[model samples]
Structure formats: structure tokens, C-alpha cells
Target: MRYKGTKAGAIVVAAVTGSVVLAGCGDGSGSQVEGGGASPSASRSADAQEQGTTEVRAAYEKTAEAESARMTIKMNLAAAGKRITSDGEGVLDLATGDSVMTITAQDKTIEQRVVDQVLYQKVPGQNAPSGKPWIKIDLEKVAGQQGLSNQQIGDPAQTAAYAKAITDKDVTKVGTENVGGVSTTHYKVSVDVSKLPGGEQMSQQLGPTLPMQVWLDDEGRLRRQQIDLTVKAPASASAKPEGSASAQQLKMSTVMQFSDFGTEVNAEAPPADQVADMTDKALQGSRQQS
Candidate 1:
């Protein structure tokens, strides 16, 4: 039980701090600017392409400028023939980079809090040698080591950074749709992962291009976004050979929805006495358990 808890804690930190971000290709169903005869209809398609590029860029800017918001997230991950689903709701203070979230998975609930750019995760009290209920991680130090900017660490959805992946030629206006009871414009774009901020490491695992869908409300703010990706599971010596029929695949899907913009969010850190830092001593213990 101790080993399992420690390993799980390590996995959570790696998953969040790593550069393996959202990726995969979206189905683009819009005009082609290449190999076109100079027809009047083709000219209109070019104009529409320009319009899509503008709209997506505008949405990115608007979302970045938001003060705060209430958000819900759903994530499904499948690997090694096992599937797990998790749901979370949170309030984010964009201005202060503070937030609180509660996530539930497999009948277990975990609470996460971020205040002043530091992250705290509630864990089983027995897992901590000091009997603390919360594990503290210095997000600023970790983000710096990972070469992530302050904005990247604060933006849980990475919505702004993801929008930077799409090029003008890759965006296609898919039409209008209702999201969360609000009318929104749907757009599909194949993300060039190489263009994403801090994307150098992720592009290798997720491939160079991936698909993403975004919905923008009337004010050009991001109402919802989704990413789906399937990647080959890393092979082990005892497991089936790579690319063989028995090889495994990992499929991950994530969706984030935003509402109640400019809401006040309070995300205070746990008291010092009840917090244990994820330091060298804890890491050494985890290594031994593995």
C-alpha cells in the first residue's frame, strides 16, 4: 500500500509536469488553397479561410484576458486493456494563478489546490511520514526545470497555448453548435504540435500533427475544447514486440468546458503543519519501493 501510494504520487507529478500535452489530428473539411483553378468560387473559399484564422486567434486572446472562470473537465484514459475515467470541477483565478479542484476517479476523490504558484495535493494521511494530509509541490521550481513559462503553469486547460498550434491554412469553420446551452461556432483544426509552446518533447510522442476541436461563443471566448489521441504503448522486454498484433495502445481523450467568467475564486494553501514537501527524502523512499 505504501509503494502504491508513492508510485501514484510520482505518476501524478510526471503527468502534470511533462510536456506530453494534448495532440492528434482533427478532421479538416474545408477549402483547399492548393491546385485550384482561378475560378470565382475558389476565390470565395480563400476568403472564408482567412475568416477562420481570424476567429480562432480572437478566441485565444479573449480567453487569455479572462479574470476567472468555473470549469469542468472530463478525461478518459485507456492503456494495457484497462480504462479509467475521471471528472473534475474547479474555479480558476486567471489573474492570480490560484485555483482549487476536486477530482473523482474509481470511487476515490482527491483535492488539489494552487496558491501563489505552488501546488498542494491531498493524500492519505498514512502516506506521509509526518502524518500530514497534504503534499506540497513547488510548481514554480518544477515549471522552471521543465522550461515552462508562468502562464503555462497557471493555465490548466492550456487553451491559449493550444490555439497557437493551428496555422492559418489548417483552420476550418465547421458551422455553429450549441455548447452548454450557449450558441457557439464550431471549428476544427489540425494542430502542428511543433508550434505549441514548450512542445518540443510532446511532438515526439504524439506525432507532429494532431486534431482539435474548439467552440467559441458570441464574444469569441472559448466555450469548450476537446482533444483525442491514440498512441502506441511503450514496449517492455517481457511484453509483445512493438507493432505486433499483441502490442498495446493507449487512447486518451479530454474535454474542458468553461462558464461563469470573472467569478471570484479562493485557493488558499494548506497550513504549514499539515503539509509535507515532496523532497529528496520522499523521492528516495519512492525509489526504493519501486
Candidate 2:
């Protein structure tokens, strides 16, 4: 087993942390479809690609404006005799910086909420004590703990953050399809970890392949996303050999779906009586690390 709250809490952790990323296109396909240059068909393809890029941005742009949505996610990762599969449903609202999500992994449930920046968590063992069922976290301090100056804290502004994450990515149309009861266009992009903001954190945990795809509705709102990657596994936890890549690779795929735009996703803090302070225990490290 990896550790408590590590594999068990992956769904929610990945959901909130990875919700806002994807990418772009190239001439291989776009140009292939164009057939030849200096022709109306090529120009039409260029215009289509341009439109596709605009539509992709518009989808997230609309999301930033809408600020709230009901979403679901499913993820699976397996490598070196270990596998983790999980699913979750939740509300996303960046306007007020609030969110509520319930993730189920390994037959366990983990629920989390963020209201006005503070995080409330209820998980097995770590939190959800008999009387004090919620663990309250100071998000700013949590950011400091992770060495982040401005961490992504699920709010209306987060969509913009997502947009910024893929700003430099290359997006290409893979055709249209039905998604979440809506007509949507599919886009695909492959990227290097060095290109994304804070994406370097992924380098250590992942293999060389990172491909992401998304579906956007006619209204320019994202309805679905699928990310495929591989996780790197270290051979030894305590020591590192001179120069070596991960000893193993875990194939991973995550799918996220969005719906209920402009709906009410009220993410309120738990009552004070049922809460325990986690700044020192969970977010902040022990005295020395602090």
C-alpha cells in the first residue's frame, strides 16, 4: 500500500488539482485534411482550426463566467502490482471560491468542501472523528506547505486558471460527437510537462506520454474531458540510484464530465461544533517542518 490518504483520497485530490488542464492541434491532421496549400480548401481548414481554437477557449471562458457546475469524474491508475480506481461527483464554483465533492475510492468515501477559502474534509481515520466529523484546513497555509504562492482553490477564478494552463497548448479538432446530451466538438492535444504551470510536479510521477482530449458544446462550454498518461514508479523509496528513470510505469486515464451550468452548487462550511483544526496536523507539517 502506498499510504493512508494517498491512494484513498486520490479522486478528490486529482479532481480539484487537475480539473483545469488540456491542449492543442497541429498540421499533421489539419494539414492532411487541407490536402494542398494555396487553395480555398486549405484556407477553409485554417479558418476551421482558428475557429476551433476560439471555440475551445470560449468553452472555458463561458465556464469562468457561469462559475458553477455539477461534475463527475472517474480515474484509474495501475503500475507495479498496484492499481487505484475511483469516481466522484461534486459542485464547482469559482465565483465565491467554494466547492463540495464526494469521492469514493477503494470502497471508501471522502468528502471535501471549500467555502471562503477554508477547506473542510471528512475522510476515514484521518478525519471524521465521532464528535468532530470535519477537519478544517487553512488553505493559504496549505499553499505554503506545498510551496505554492497561489494555489488553485476551486472558485470561479479557477476556470481562468485552467484556461491559462492550456494557453500555450496546441489544440486540434477530432470531429464532433454527442456528449452529455449535447452536440459537442472534440479536441485533442499532447503536451510536455515543462509547458504547463506547475506541470513539472508531474514529471516525477509520470512517464513520457501525456495526451488529453476534451469535448465542448455548441455554446462553447466544456462538457467532457479525457486524459491518458502513465505514472512513474520509483524502485526505492529511501534512496535514489545514480541516474535512472522510474523503475516501473503505471498506465492512467481520467475522465471528467460537466453539466448543470448556472445551477446552485452551494458549498457551505460544516458547523463549528463538528469540526477539528487541521492546520497544524494536516496542512502544516510537524513543529520542525513548520
Candidate 3:
């Protein structure tokens, strides 16, 4: 199996969701906003000044915090003339810089923990041996179950790295829009992904450049963001590389939706009593194997 299934698994677990604004520096002859002969950069600076960087940053922080709370994400994957729908709830731990997601479908349950740039999936009946640096989660086996490889989960440090990428760039007010019935300010930010520390890695994952339109509420929380992701996959890889005639080109448009703010429930710690049952199950399964 090609392992495209890993995408779905990772999406289910680590929906923990960037920042920055950049200015178009190519030409000084760009269209002016309200002021005469003003570049896009000038316009953005004016807006930020009107809002005050301190206030804007505060708003961004509040929104970021709110967004990190309880969220229900619905993922729909369409491929090979088949569509699969998965629903999951996630709690973002800003303190530990991690996200815990639990998703259940039919009789299968998957609990995923994304921490320190690694994604771990614990199946209902399988227990990994303790103290492993990282256990490779077989995404193929967990296609409809739950799992993620290190590469697919992404690095947490990259998140902060990307945030700093466009810190000095300008943010233009793109007007107001309503999301989930909440009025929000839309900002058009131009960020150079190649400038950040992990920019190369993110660019590889997203392919080339990434342009995003971010929406924020009056409180400065991110309501939604839309990025046009263009990924180039080889033809043979896109199809099924038989006899290696080079990879085919494949393109997909991904729209990631975020919603249900301020709904994060408190983290439910695992019960101490449950450990004995899990250990017994693991031992029993191991004996059966022997």
C-alpha cells in the first residue's frame, strides 16, 4: 500500500493548528489604499498603528488561546471514487504544546497524543513496550484505525518558527466577514515561507509557496484561514508506479475548516485503576502470541 492513508490518520489526531504578515516589495507602483502613492506595506503599517501593535498582538494571543480550546473537526477524504468521513474532538494543551484527540467510528476507537513533535496512537487493545524513543505507528495497518509517522505529524517547533517568519511583515485589513454567524475581520497577509527556520520543510510539505487569508474575530481570535495548497506528486506515484516510468503529476485542493470555539473540556486524566486492566490485556495478548 502506498501509505497515503497516513494523511487521514494524522489529520484525525493533530488538528492543532500560524502567523505573520508580509508586504509586497516587488514594485513601488502598486495600487494605493486611502492615502495617495502609498505602497501595500505603508497601508498595512497604518492599519497596525491604528489598532496599535500591542492591542493587535493581544488580540491575536486571545484568539489563539480560544482556538486552542475544545474543537470538533470534521474531515472528509475523497479518493479512488470513495469518500470517507471522520469526526473527532481535540484539546490543545498550550502549556505542554501538545494536542490530544480521540475519535471513534463504528466499533473502533483511536486516542492520539501529539507532543514534542511526535504523534503517538494508542489502540484500544494494543500496548507499546515502555520507554521507546519513538514507536513507528504503521499508518497502513491503522488506515481506518489511528496512527501517524513522525514525518506526517510535523514538528511543534516549526509552528513557532513560522510565527516569527512574518512578524515584521505588514497586516492589511481585508474587511469583515461572518463565519459560523460571528462577524470577523479578514486580514490579507503575505508571508515568505522560505525565510523561516523550518520554512524549507514546511514549503516541501505544502509545496513551493503558501499564501493564506486569515480571519479574526473582534477579540483577535482566528476564526478561519484559507490557503491554496499546490502539491506536485509524481505521475507514477499518483497512480501506481508500475515499472517506474517516472511519477505522475497530481494536484489536490485542501480546505481546512475550524469551528466550535470556547468549547474545550478539561483534560480527563487516565484513571489509575485502568492501568491494571491494560497491563493484563497486553500480557494476555503477548502470551497468545507466544
Candidate number of the best TM-score:
1
Runs in model 2 with CA error above 4 Å?
A: 1-3, 6-17, 21-41, 78-81, 116-119, 123-131, 136-169, 191-195, 198-210, 229-239, 242-252, 277-290
Computed on alpha carbons, the lDDT of every model, listed in order, comes to: 0.60, 0.57, 0.42
Per-residue lDDT, model 1, residue 11, is 34
**Model 1, span 1-290: residue lDDT tens:** 44334333333333322221232111122232222223244778877766666566556446546767887877777655557777878987655556788877666787878677666777443446667887776665543433344434444355445545655666778999998999999888676767776566546445777767778899877788776766443232224555576554546676778899887798898889888887444444333422
Which candidate number maximizes lDDT?
Answer: 1
Residues 1-290 of candidate 2: C-alpha lDDT, one tens digit per residue: 32224422422343344445332222112212211112235667766765665566455555556667888878786654567788878987735647788878778887887677676778656544445767776665554344332433333333433343332234578998998789998988544454344556555554333567888877767788887765443323214452445344446677888889877887888889888775655532211222
Give the worst 10-residue stretch by lDDT in candidate 1.
Answer: 18-27
The residue ranges of model 3 lying beyond 4 angstroms of the native Cα positions read 1-8, 11-60, 64-68, 76-85, 102-111, 122-160, 167-172, 200-208, 232-290
Cα lDDT tens digits for candidate 3, 70-97: 5444455443333445666676643333
TM-score of 1: 0.70
Q: Once all C-alphas are superposed, what RMSD does model 2 give against the true structure?
A: 6.9
Candidate that beats the other on lDDT, 2 or 3, i.e. the better one: 2
Best-to-worst order by lDDT is 1, 2, 3
Q: For candidate 2, which ten residues in a row score worst on lDDT?
A: 27-36
